[model samples]
Target: MQLTQSSSVEIPMNDAKEVDSVTLEPVDSQSGMDGGLKAWLTVVGGWIAGFCTFGAANSFGVYQALYTLEGTSSASNISWIGSLQLCLIFAMGILTGKLFDAGYFHHMQIAGMLLYVFSHFLLSP
Candidate 1:
Protein backbone atom coordinates (compact mmCIF):
# COMPACT_ATOMS: atom_id res chain seq x y z
CA MET A 1 0.00 0.00 0.00
CA GLN A 2 1.36 3.45 -1.03
CA LEU A 3 -0.24 6.66 0.31
CA THR A 4 0.75 10.31 0.15
CA GLN A 5 -1.11 11.94 3.09
CA SER A 6 -4.23 10.24 1.64
CA SER A 7 -5.48 6.73 2.36
CA SER A 8 -5.20 4.77 -0.91
CA VAL A 9 -4.44 1.12 -1.68
CA GLU A 10 -2.37 0.50 -4.84
CA ILE A 11 -2.55 -3.07 -6.13
CA PRO A 12 0.48 -4.23 -8.11
CA MET A 13 -0.33 -5.29 -11.70
CA ASN A 14 1.37 -8.47 -13.03
CA ASP A 15 1.88 -9.09 -16.77
CA ALA A 16 2.24 -12.87 -16.30
CA LYS A 17 0.07 -13.75 -19.29
CA GLU A 18 2.20 -11.52 -21.52
CA VAL A 19 5.36 -13.10 -20.09
CA ASP A 20 3.89 -16.62 -20.58
CA SER A 21 3.08 -15.84 -24.18
CA VAL A 22 6.81 -15.36 -24.87
CA THR A 23 7.82 -18.98 -25.65
CA LEU A 24 11.37 -20.22 -25.97
CA GLU A 25 12.64 -21.75 -29.20
CA PRO A 26 14.87 -24.82 -28.72
CA VAL A 27 18.12 -24.98 -30.69
CA ASP A 28 19.53 -28.11 -32.33
CA SER A 29 23.09 -27.83 -31.00
CA GLN A 30 23.91 -31.42 -30.06
CA SER A 31 24.61 -34.04 -32.71
CA GLY A 32 22.85 -37.40 -32.84
CA MET A 33 24.48 -40.30 -30.86
CA ASP A 34 23.35 -43.33 -32.89
CA GLY A 35 25.59 -46.37 -32.33
CA GLY A 36 26.44 -46.91 -35.96
CA LEU A 37 29.67 -47.80 -37.78
CA LYS A 38 31.39 -44.49 -37.05
CA ALA A 39 30.37 -44.65 -33.39
CA TRP A 40 31.73 -48.22 -33.10
CA LEU A 41 34.96 -47.14 -34.80
CA THR A 42 35.34 -44.31 -32.30
CA VAL A 43 34.85 -46.79 -29.43
CA VAL A 44 37.50 -49.11 -30.92
CA GLY A 45 39.88 -46.20 -31.38
CA GLY A 46 39.38 -45.24 -27.74
CA TRP A 47 40.03 -48.82 -26.65
CA ILE A 48 43.25 -48.99 -28.68
CA ALA A 49 44.43 -45.66 -27.29
CA GLY A 50 43.67 -46.71 -23.72
CA PHE A 51 45.44 -50.05 -24.14
CA CYS A 52 48.51 -48.49 -25.76
CA THR A 53 48.97 -45.97 -22.97
CA PHE A 54 47.69 -47.63 -19.79
CA GLY A 55 48.68 -51.13 -20.92
CA ALA A 56 52.23 -49.89 -21.45
CA ALA A 57 52.24 -48.56 -17.89
CA ASN A 58 50.99 -51.92 -16.60
CA SER A 59 53.90 -53.71 -18.34
CA PHE A 60 56.49 -51.69 -16.39
CA GLY A 61 57.38 -54.78 -14.35
CA VAL A 62 58.72 -56.51 -17.47
CA TYR A 63 60.48 -53.28 -18.49
CA GLN A 64 62.08 -52.83 -15.06
CA ALA A 65 63.27 -56.41 -14.97
CA LEU A 66 64.81 -56.17 -18.43
CA TYR A 67 66.41 -52.83 -17.65
CA THR A 68 67.82 -54.22 -14.40
CA LEU A 69 69.32 -57.23 -16.27
CA GLU A 70 70.86 -54.94 -18.88
CA GLY A 71 72.23 -52.57 -16.15
CA THR A 72 71.00 -49.70 -18.37
CA SER A 73 69.91 -47.57 -15.39
CA SER A 74 69.65 -47.73 -11.60
CA ALA A 75 66.45 -49.05 -9.95
CA SER A 76 65.44 -45.58 -8.68
CA ASN A 77 66.23 -43.99 -12.04
CA ILE A 78 64.33 -46.69 -13.97
CA SER A 79 61.33 -46.32 -11.68
CA TRP A 80 61.38 -42.59 -12.31
CA ILE A 81 61.35 -43.24 -16.07
CA GLY A 82 58.24 -45.47 -15.81
CA SER A 83 56.47 -42.99 -13.52
CA LEU A 84 57.37 -40.08 -15.79
CA GLN A 85 56.11 -41.95 -18.86
CA LEU A 86 52.83 -42.84 -17.14
CA CYS A 87 52.42 -39.26 -15.89
CA LEU A 88 53.02 -37.86 -19.37
CA ILE A 89 50.61 -40.38 -20.92
CA PHE A 90 47.79 -39.39 -18.55
CA ALA A 91 48.59 -35.66 -18.67
CA MET A 92 48.66 -35.63 -22.45
CA GLY A 93 45.36 -37.55 -22.64
CA ILE A 94 43.64 -34.35 -21.42
CA LEU A 95 45.34 -32.35 -24.17
CA THR A 96 44.39 -34.97 -26.77
CA GLY A 97 40.76 -34.97 -25.56
CA LYS A 98 40.66 -31.18 -25.97
CA LEU A 99 42.13 -31.45 -29.45
CA PHE A 100 39.53 -34.12 -30.30
CA ASP A 101 36.74 -31.86 -29.00
CA ALA A 102 38.10 -29.14 -31.30
CA GLY A 103 37.87 -31.53 -34.31
CA TYR A 104 41.60 -32.27 -34.53
CA PHE A 105 41.59 -35.97 -33.64
CA HIS A 106 43.16 -37.26 -36.88
CA HIS A 107 45.89 -34.63 -36.88
CA MET A 108 46.69 -35.27 -33.23
CA GLN A 109 46.71 -39.06 -33.77
CA ILE A 110 49.08 -38.70 -36.73
CA ALA A 111 51.34 -36.47 -34.68
CA GLY A 112 51.26 -39.01 -31.84
CA MET A 113 52.09 -41.90 -34.19
CA LEU A 114 55.01 -39.94 -35.64
CA LEU A 115 56.25 -39.08 -32.16
CA TYR A 116 56.03 -42.75 -31.12
CA VAL A 117 57.94 -43.89 -34.19
CA PHE A 118 60.58 -41.18 -33.65
CA SER A 119 60.96 -42.18 -30.02
CA HIS A 120 61.48 -45.82 -31.06
CA PHE A 121 64.08 -44.72 -33.58
CA LEU A 122 65.88 -42.81 -30.86
CA LEU A 123 65.83 -45.93 -28.63
CA SER A 124 67.49 -48.06 -31.37
CA PRO A 125 70.98 -47.26 -30.04
Candidate 2:
Protein backbone atom coordinates (compact mmCIF):
# COMPACT_ATOMS: atom_id res chain seq x y z
CA MET A 1 0.00 0.00 0.00
CA GLN A 2 1.48 3.32 -1.07
CA LEU A 3 1.28 5.93 1.68
CA THR A 4 0.41 9.38 0.49
CA GLN A 5 -0.19 12.74 2.15
CA SER A 6 -3.94 12.18 2.28
CA SER A 7 -3.29 8.76 3.85
CA SER A 8 -1.57 8.33 7.19
CA VAL A 9 1.92 6.87 6.78
CA GLU A 10 2.99 4.52 9.51
CA ILE A 11 6.73 4.31 9.12
CA PRO A 12 8.51 1.70 11.14
CA MET A 13 12.17 2.57 11.58
CA ASN A 14 13.11 -1.09 11.98
CA ASP A 15 11.86 -1.86 8.49
CA ALA A 16 14.23 -0.66 5.73
CA LYS A 17 11.62 -1.24 3.06
CA GLU A 18 9.17 1.06 4.82
CA VAL A 19 11.83 3.75 4.98
CA ASP A 20 12.59 3.34 1.28
CA SER A 21 8.88 3.54 0.53
CA VAL A 22 8.84 7.10 1.84
CA THR A 23 11.80 8.40 -0.12
CA LEU A 24 10.97 10.72 -3.03
CA GLU A 25 12.77 9.40 -6.10
CA PRO A 26 14.21 12.30 -8.05
CA VAL A 27 12.87 13.12 -11.52
CA ASP A 28 13.58 15.94 -13.98
CA SER A 29 15.29 18.21 -11.48
CA GLN A 30 15.83 20.87 -14.13
CA SER A 31 12.13 21.33 -14.70
CA GLY A 32 11.64 22.49 -11.12
CA MET A 33 15.08 23.60 -9.93
CA ASP A 34 16.03 25.73 -12.92
CA GLY A 35 16.16 29.41 -11.99
CA GLY A 36 13.15 31.52 -12.81
CA LEU A 37 11.03 34.30 -11.33
CA LYS A 38 9.20 31.90 -9.02
CA ALA A 39 12.49 30.25 -7.96
CA TRP A 40 14.10 33.61 -7.15
CA LEU A 41 10.98 34.71 -5.27
CA THR A 42 11.03 31.54 -3.25
CA VAL A 43 14.66 32.15 -2.34
CA VAL A 44 13.85 35.71 -1.32
CA GLY A 45 10.83 34.60 0.66
CA GLY A 46 12.93 31.92 2.42
CA TRP A 47 15.62 34.46 3.30
CA ILE A 48 12.97 36.82 4.71
CA ALA A 49 11.38 34.02 6.73
CA GLY A 50 14.78 32.83 7.98
CA PHE A 51 15.68 36.29 9.21
CA CYS A 52 12.28 36.90 10.75
CA THR A 53 12.04 33.53 12.51
CA PHE A 54 15.56 33.92 13.86
CA GLY A 55 14.67 37.37 15.16
CA ALA A 56 11.45 36.08 16.68
CA ALA A 57 13.27 33.17 18.34
CA ASN A 58 15.81 35.57 19.79
CA SER A 59 13.03 37.92 20.90
CA PHE A 60 11.82 35.30 23.36
CA GLY A 61 14.43 36.63 25.75
CA VAL A 62 12.86 40.06 25.43
CA TYR A 63 9.43 38.62 26.13
CA GLN A 64 10.79 36.71 29.10
CA ALA A 65 12.30 39.88 30.47
CA LEU A 66 9.09 41.83 29.92
CA TYR A 67 7.01 39.20 31.64
CA THR A 68 9.40 39.13 34.55
CA LEU A 69 9.29 42.90 34.85
CA GLU A 70 5.53 43.05 34.58
CA GLY A 71 5.13 40.80 37.64
CA THR A 72 2.38 38.89 35.87
CA SER A 73 3.86 35.58 36.97
CA SER A 74 6.91 33.86 38.33
CA ALA A 75 9.92 33.08 36.14
CA SER A 76 8.89 29.43 35.88
CA ASN A 77 5.37 30.09 34.66
CA ILE A 78 6.47 32.88 32.33
CA SER A 79 9.01 30.62 30.67
CA TRP A 80 6.23 28.41 29.33
CA ILE A 81 5.10 31.15 26.94
CA GLY A 82 8.43 31.17 25.15
CA SER A 83 8.67 27.40 25.22
CA LEU A 84 5.18 27.11 23.71
CA GLN A 85 6.11 29.58 20.97
CA LEU A 86 9.21 27.58 20.03
CA CYS A 87 7.35 24.29 20.12
CA LEU A 88 4.51 25.61 17.97
CA ILE A 89 6.94 27.00 15.40
CA PHE A 90 8.67 23.62 15.03
CA ALA A 91 5.38 21.71 14.98
CA MET A 92 3.84 24.02 12.41
CA GLY A 93 6.93 23.79 10.22
CA ILE A 94 6.56 20.03 10.02
CA LEU A 95 2.82 20.21 9.35
CA THR A 96 2.94 23.05 6.83
CA GLY A 97 5.93 21.72 4.91
CA LYS A 98 4.03 18.53 4.31
CA LEU A 99 0.95 20.52 3.33
CA PHE A 100 3.04 22.51 0.86
CA ASP A 101 4.44 19.30 -0.65
CA ALA A 102 0.86 18.10 -1.03
CA GLY A 103 -0.17 21.26 -2.94
CA TYR A 104 -1.92 23.07 -0.11
CA PHE A 105 0.33 26.10 -0.35
CA HIS A 106 -2.40 28.72 -0.87
CA HIS A 107 -4.58 27.40 1.93
CA MET A 108 -1.66 27.09 4.29
CA GLN A 109 -0.35 30.53 3.39
CA ILE A 110 -3.70 32.18 4.05
CA ALA A 111 -4.24 30.27 7.25
CA GLY A 112 -0.76 31.19 8.42
CA MET A 113 -1.35 34.85 7.74
CA LEU A 114 -4.67 34.78 9.56
CA LEU A 115 -3.19 32.97 12.52
CA TYR A 116 -0.28 35.42 12.72
CA VAL A 117 -2.65 38.37 12.64
CA PHE A 118 -4.88 36.73 15.22
CA SER A 119 -1.96 36.11 17.53
CA HIS A 120 -1.01 39.75 17.34
CA PHE A 121 -4.62 40.69 18.01
CA LEU A 122 -4.70 38.52 21.10
CA LEU A 123 -1.38 39.86 22.32
CA SER A 124 -2.55 43.43 22.00
CA PRO A 125 -4.64 43.11 25.14
Candidate 3:
Protein backbone atom coordinates (compact mmCIF):
# COMPACT_ATOMS: atom_id res chain seq x y z
CA MET A 1 0.00 0.00 0.00
CA GLN A 2 1.25 3.48 -0.97
CA LEU A 3 0.22 6.67 0.96
CA THR A 4 0.60 10.20 -0.53
CA GLN A 5 0.75 13.47 1.50
CA SER A 6 -0.01 16.90 -0.04
CA SER A 7 1.25 20.25 1.39
CA SER A 8 -0.72 23.51 1.02
CA VAL A 9 1.13 26.48 -0.54
CA GLU A 10 0.57 30.12 0.56
CA ILE A 11 0.34 32.91 -1.96
CA PRO A 12 1.92 36.37 -1.30
CA MET A 13 0.97 39.70 -2.94
CA ASN A 14 3.80 41.82 -4.36
CA ASP A 15 1.86 45.14 -4.58
CA ALA A 16 -0.96 46.66 -2.43
CA LYS A 17 -3.16 49.72 -3.14
CA GLU A 18 -2.58 52.77 -0.92
CA VAL A 19 -5.56 54.36 0.82
CA ASP A 20 -6.19 58.09 0.33
CA SER A 21 -5.45 60.43 3.23
CA VAL A 22 -8.43 61.97 5.05
CA THR A 23 -8.94 65.70 5.63
CA LEU A 24 -10.84 66.99 8.69
CA GLU A 25 -12.81 70.25 8.92
CA PRO A 26 -12.04 72.72 11.64
CA VAL A 27 -14.61 73.21 14.42
CA ASP A 28 -16.47 76.51 14.67
CA SER A 29 -15.57 78.68 17.67
CA GLN A 30 -19.13 79.71 18.53
CA SER A 31 -21.04 76.45 18.39
CA GLY A 32 -23.18 76.84 21.49
CA MET A 33 -23.49 79.24 24.45
CA ASP A 34 -23.35 76.52 27.06
CA GLY A 35 -19.64 77.03 27.86
CA GLY A 36 -17.37 80.11 27.98
CA LEU A 37 -16.53 83.06 30.15
CA LYS A 38 -20.19 84.09 30.38
CA ALA A 39 -21.27 80.69 31.67
CA TRP A 40 -18.53 80.65 34.30
CA LEU A 41 -19.42 84.16 35.38
CA THR A 42 -23.04 83.09 35.75
CA VAL A 43 -22.09 80.21 38.01
CA VAL A 44 -19.91 82.43 40.17
CA GLY A 45 -22.60 85.07 40.39
CA GLY A 46 -25.22 82.50 41.34
CA TRP A 47 -23.04 81.15 44.13
CA ILE A 48 -22.41 84.63 45.47
CA ALA A 49 -26.10 85.46 45.35
CA GLY A 50 -27.05 82.23 47.09
CA PHE A 51 -24.50 82.72 49.83
CA CYS A 52 -25.42 86.34 50.46
CA THR A 53 -29.16 85.66 50.71
CA PHE A 54 -29.49 82.15 52.11
CA GLY A 55 -26.34 82.52 54.18
CA ALA A 56 -28.01 85.18 56.28
CA ALA A 57 -29.77 82.35 58.04
CA ASN A 58 -26.57 81.66 59.93
CA SER A 59 -27.04 85.02 61.70
CA PHE A 60 -30.15 83.66 63.30
CA GLY A 61 -28.29 83.27 66.57
CA VAL A 62 -27.77 87.04 66.74
CA TYR A 63 -31.36 87.77 65.87
CA GLN A 64 -32.60 85.14 68.30
CA ALA A 65 -30.57 86.60 71.16
CA LEU A 66 -31.80 90.07 70.41
CA TYR A 67 -35.40 88.98 70.07
CA THR A 68 -35.24 87.07 73.35
CA LEU A 69 -33.76 90.00 75.20
CA GLU A 70 -36.29 92.40 73.68
CA GLY A 71 -39.08 90.11 74.94
CA THR A 72 -41.27 90.93 71.94
CA SER A 73 -41.41 87.29 70.78
CA SER A 74 -40.66 84.00 72.46
CA ALA A 75 -37.50 82.11 71.62
CA SER A 76 -39.57 79.19 70.37
CA ASN A 77 -41.48 81.36 67.90
CA ILE A 78 -38.31 83.01 66.57
CA SER A 79 -36.70 79.60 66.24
CA TRP A 80 -39.53 78.48 63.97
CA ILE A 81 -38.97 81.51 61.73
CA GLY A 82 -35.32 80.62 61.30
CA SER A 83 -36.19 76.98 60.65
CA LEU A 84 -38.65 77.94 57.92
CA GLN A 85 -36.10 80.23 56.26
CA LEU A 86 -33.53 77.44 56.29
CA CYS A 87 -35.99 74.97 54.78
CA LEU A 88 -36.83 77.36 51.93
CA ILE A 89 -33.16 78.03 51.23
CA PHE A 90 -32.43 74.29 50.98
CA ALA A 91 -35.52 73.62 48.88
CA MET A 92 -34.53 76.27 46.32
CA GLY A 93 -31.51 74.13 45.41
CA ILE A 94 -33.81 71.69 43.65
CA LEU A 95 -35.21 74.31 41.31
CA THR A 96 -31.82 75.93 40.75
CA GLY A 97 -30.23 72.60 39.83
CA LYS A 98 -32.95 71.84 37.32
CA LEU A 99 -32.73 75.27 35.73
CA PHE A 100 -28.98 75.09 35.52
CA ASP A 101 -29.14 71.73 33.76
CA ALA A 102 -31.57 73.23 31.26
CA GLY A 103 -29.00 75.85 30.21
CA TYR A 104 -30.96 78.66 31.85
CA PHE A 105 -28.48 79.12 34.65
CA HIS A 106 -27.37 82.54 33.44
CA HIS A 107 -30.87 83.89 33.32
CA MET A 108 -31.69 82.35 36.64
CA GLN A 109 -28.53 83.70 38.18
CA ILE A 110 -29.17 87.23 36.97
CA ALA A 111 -32.74 87.10 38.18
CA GLY A 112 -31.69 85.74 41.53
CA MET A 113 -29.12 88.51 42.00
CA LEU A 114 -31.62 91.16 41.07
CA LEU A 115 -34.16 89.72 43.44
CA TYR A 116 -31.63 89.53 46.23
CA VAL A 117 -30.66 93.17 45.76
CA PHE A 118 -34.23 94.33 45.40
CA SER A 119 -35.41 92.44 48.46
CA HIS A 120 -32.74 94.02 50.62
CA PHE A 121 -33.30 97.47 49.20
CA LEU A 122 -37.04 97.34 49.73
CA LEU A 123 -36.91 95.61 53.09
CA SER A 124 -34.33 97.98 54.50
CA PRO A 125 -37.09 100.30 55.60
Better of 1 and 2 by lDDT: 2
Worst 10 residues of 1 by lDDT: 20-29
Q: Tens-digit lDDT track for model 3 on 44-96?
A: 97698667875787877787888789898899997997898789888988998
Score candidate 1 by TM-score against the native.
0.64
Backbone clash pairs for candidate 2 read none
Note the residue pairs that clash in candidate 3.
Answer: none
lDDT of model 1 at position 98:
87
Task: Please name the candidate that would achieve the greatest lDDT relative to the true structure.
Answer: 2
* Count of clashes in candidate 1: 0
lDDT of all predictions? 0.74, 0.75, 0.72
Model 2 Cα lDDT, one tens digit per residue, 17-115 = 535445344445456756779889999998987787767776877777877898988889978888898888888888788888999988977887788
lDDT of 1 by residue, 1-125 (tens): 34443344444447665443432333333644566698899889889988886776888778788887899888888888779888898788788788889999789889988997786586443
Any residue pairs clashing in model 1, and if so which?
none
Q: TM-score rank, highest first?
A: 2, 1, 3
